[model samples]
Target: METRQEAVTGTIGCATAVLGAFAGIAVWFPYGRTALFGAFEGETNPTDLWLGLPVLALGGAATAVAVLTAVQGRRRIAVGLAAATAALAAFGYAFDVLAAPQALQDCGSPC
Candidate 1:
């Protein structure tokens, strides 16, 4: 049987890991697709690049902080913040992915 401390640590670790993984996917999945297939021709909207890179950095920072705090048992607030950050990044990536189609559709050939 797991002790109380062990159980708590295990739960925290699991949550932190899941949060971290989702955060990674949130950022990577969108950008990875662009990298794999190449950007749309005449795609000049810099918004995706501008938005994605920062969130990935923020998510990374949050994940690091969450894992550290969870391990030390000094704070749960950081873990909560990390989860929120991950969710926000996921939403942001989804937004960018969804918007890409519309953005491309709006571009016209002027030449």
Candidate 2:
């Protein structure tokens, strides 16, 4: 039987690893660009406000559930679920096509 401490540690470790992957994807993925080219399409990246944030939120929820289960004495299952949660975040926008660096040109700043 696993102790509360051990289970919690495992869950956190897995969750943290997922979050690390999330950070890497965010830094490298294009957050701003034209989703489609057209005269009135304007410039906007729907992936940001739509896709990325939601998956992160879902992962957070899964992490929360994992912690909850860990405290209940189901460490192994909790760890697996927590890892799955984190993976869900990566599924969001992490694998999208990379756009030209100049398209958005540093979204938060002037390109």
Which candidate leads in TM-score?
1
**After TM-score superposition, what is the CA distance of residue 4 in candidate 1 from its true location, in Å?**
31
| Total clashing pairs in model 1 | 0
Instruction: Give the Å shift of residue 71 in candidate 1.
Output: 0.8
Cα lDDT tens digits, model 1, 1-111, are 889998987687666666665666575656645643446663444455556555565575567657667667767777696777779668676766324533356558852
Q: In each prediction, how many residue pairs overlap at the backbone (N, C-alpha, C within less than 3 A)?
A: 0, 0
- Quote model 2's TM-score: 0.45
Against the reference, the lDDT scores of all candidates come to 0.62, 0.58
The CA root-mean-square deviation of candidate 1, after full C-alpha superposition on the true structure, stands at 7.5
lDDT of 2: 0.58
Per-residue lDDT of candidate 2, residues 26-83 (tens digit): 6444443344331122554554545554555556556766766788799998989878
Query: What's the TM-score of each model vs. the native?
Result: 0.46, 0.45
Stretch of 10 with least lDDT, candidate 2: 32-41
- On a 0 to 1 TM-score scale, where does candidate 1 land against the true structure? 0.46
Q: Which candidate number maximizes lDDT?
A: 1
